[model samples]
Structure formats: structure tokens, C-alpha cells
Target: MTEIPLEHVHVAPDEESGGEPAPAVFVLHGRGADEEDLLPVAAELPDELHVVSLRAPDPLQGGYTWYELDLSAGGLESSQPDADDFRRSLDLIGESVERAVDAYGLDADRLGLLGFSQGAITSLSLLLEDPDRYAWVVALHGYLAESHADLDPDGIEGKPVFVGAGAGDRVIPESRTTAAVERFETLDADVASGSFPGGHGIGPQELDAVVEFVASRTA
Candidate 1:
């Protein structure tokens, strides 16, 4: 697992990490977006949580992407990230998680994931690969990748997951969202799903749900 370079931000409670470890959440932004893109959302989340926003490693049209989508497969079926590249990114993220734990004295059991759009897809990918590595996940306007279907469903059983999709999202069709939710449910994940009346973006209502979801997990 080679470590790929990643720019990121970490925010934790003002108090020193002398006592119990704090809860932490890794925030991932959408495709063509930078690490700072999700800072506002992180700010709105619970202050007690140690938030870390990561920048995707791959550069795109003046922005960044987790991996390149393989259009040849049709309908965003796969991302054409070389095995090494993908593994490096995943390793980088894991390194980031370890760094957060050491920095904030975070409880490994309370680590969570929050991602939007392409980030959301990556979050699911990470979670599926190592469910215990993450305590909970909030995926907004994202769908599961085909690779996820090959994973062992029992790995994620009983884990908490919040999947929020926009009903009017043209970017990700309802069918995709439906498939994502159904996949998690089939794996026996403790799924909490909602649909907002908007497009491929999060709104006030969805934010409220996100806040509540994190609060519940971090509480």
C-alpha cells in the first residue's frame, strides 16, 4: 500500500486530547471539487467531531477526481483507476485516518465517513472493503459502484449507513439510488435513507438530516 500525497484539513475541538478520544469523521468532496469544497458542510456538523477533509489525488479539469470513470463500460459502470493508483489512494486515506486518530486522540471505534457525489461513491467503496474500519457513513447524491457487488455482504451487516439522494437528480437517476439503497439493505446494513426534492446537490432539509445523522452516531 503505497501512500499517495493528499492535501487535507483537520478540525478538532479546542481542548487538548488529554482525556477520552474524540469522535472523527473524514469528509470527501465530489468530482471536480477540491478539499475545501466540503468545509462549509463540515463546519455545520457537530463541533465535537474531529473533521478531516481530503483532496482527491487525481487532477481533472482544474479540479480533482477520485478516479476516472470508464465510460466504455457504459453508464458509469466503473472507474478506470489503475490497481496501483486506486490502492495508493485508499492507502493514503487510511494513513489520513491514522493521522487523525493520533492528532485528535480519536477513538478508532467512532471514526465515520461523509462524502458527496463522487466522494460518496468512494466512501461506499471504502466501507464495503473494510466495514469495521468505519463506524458509520453518510453518502449524499451518490450511488454504489459495480465493484461493490463483488464484496462480501456480511462484512457490512448491522453497520449504520445514511444514504441521501435527490429525487430530481439528473446526474444520478433514481434507479441508481434505488440500487444503492437495495444493495445496502441486502447486506443487512442499518440503513437510513431519504430523498430530497432537488437535483444533484444537497439542500437545507438534507443538511438537517445529515446533521441529525452525525449527531446520533457521534452521541
Candidate 2:
């Protein structure tokens, strides 16, 4: 595996695994957020999961972002990703995950993904690009990139996918998220969805659902 190209941190498993490799969840934070932004929540997951949080490659206003957003003609709801930057990140992140699987003593068969906002968009894209790569996926407050809609979903059958967003979320728009859910369903993935009040962030109920979805697989 290649060296990890992005900065990252890890939360070790809660309990000792008797030296056996542990299942791991690779975490990605939203745009303008660092690796530490989701550390607290990633820790909330069951100790069985070894969590690795990665910082986005690009530096933004006091934070990091996975890719650049082109909002010149549209607002957040219609904003598009810089295709070149977005494509680059997809490859970068995928390579980092390969390195992580070996470096972190991660169980290759049970790898998972968790992402928020822009991070969520990237996570979903990675899963689509390689359907069998992850055991499950959790995406919050983000929408699918239109660029990835044409990918073949051949190996994604019965995949566990949880997508959540606030009904009032103006940042990504609930409609966009719902569209992602529908797309997953069309691919025959076992998708779980949640809608909460307010906008553009994870709510308490939403977080609990994410935890449960991951725990079931790890436990």
C-alpha cells in the first residue's frame, strides 16, 4: 500500500482485541473542518471499532476541506464541486484507506466509512466507486455528487447505508439528500434514512441512529 497522503488521527479500540486486528471505521469531517472536528463523536461509537479520522487535504478558512466548491452561479443548494479537485480527493482518500488497513491493524473485510457534510459526499462517492470496499457507510448533512451517478452499482447489493439530514437544512437541502437515498435504493442497497428538525447538522436522534447502525455490524 502507498503512504497515506492526508494528515490523520486514530482512536484505538475500547477493549483489547487479544492482538487480533480490529474492525475499523475511517472518518471524514465536513468542509472547513479538521481531523479533530469529529473526534469526539467518532469516539462515541462502540469501542470495538478502531476509528481513524482524516483531515481534508486542502486548507480552507481556518479549517480543511476535501475539495473546492464552485458556487459562483448558485448558492449552497446548487453549488458544484470543482471536478478536478473532487476527483483528486477521491483517489487520495482511497489510497489512504488502503495504507490505513495495513498500518492500523484494521480488518480488511469489515471496513466502514463515516462522513459529515462535504465529508459525507466523499464517503458516498468512495463507496460507489468501489462497491465492495466498505462493509457499511454513514453520511450526514451531505448530498451525492452528480458526477458519480453513472457508476455501476454491481457489487453494492445489500450494503448498509444510513443517510441523515435536518428537514430545514438549507445548506445541502433535504431534497438532495432524499435523492441520494432513492438512488441507493435503486442500487438495491439496504439504506436507512433519518430526518430531524432544524438544518445542516447532526441532531441527537440522528447521532444515535448512526451509532446503532455501526454497532450492529461490529457487535
- Displacement of the residue 58 alpha carbon in candidate 2, Å: 0.7
- On the 0 to 100 scale, the lDDT of residue 136 in model 2 is 95
Residue-wise C-alpha lDDT for candidate 1, range 150-191, written one tens digit per residue:
677456998999999998988776667778889899889999
The CA lDDT at 96 in model 1 is 78
- Cα-lDDT of candidate 1: 0.81
Candidate 1 pairs with clashing backbones: none
Pick out the ten consecutive residues of candidate 1 with the lowest summed lDDT.
76-85
What's the CA error at residue 166 for candidate 1, in Å?
A: 1.1
Q: What residue pairs are clashing in model 2?
A: none
* Per-model C-alpha RMSD: 2.9, 1.4
Clashes of 1: 0
lDDT string for model 2 (107-188, tens) is 8988999999999999999999997899999999888888987676778989999999889998889999999999999989
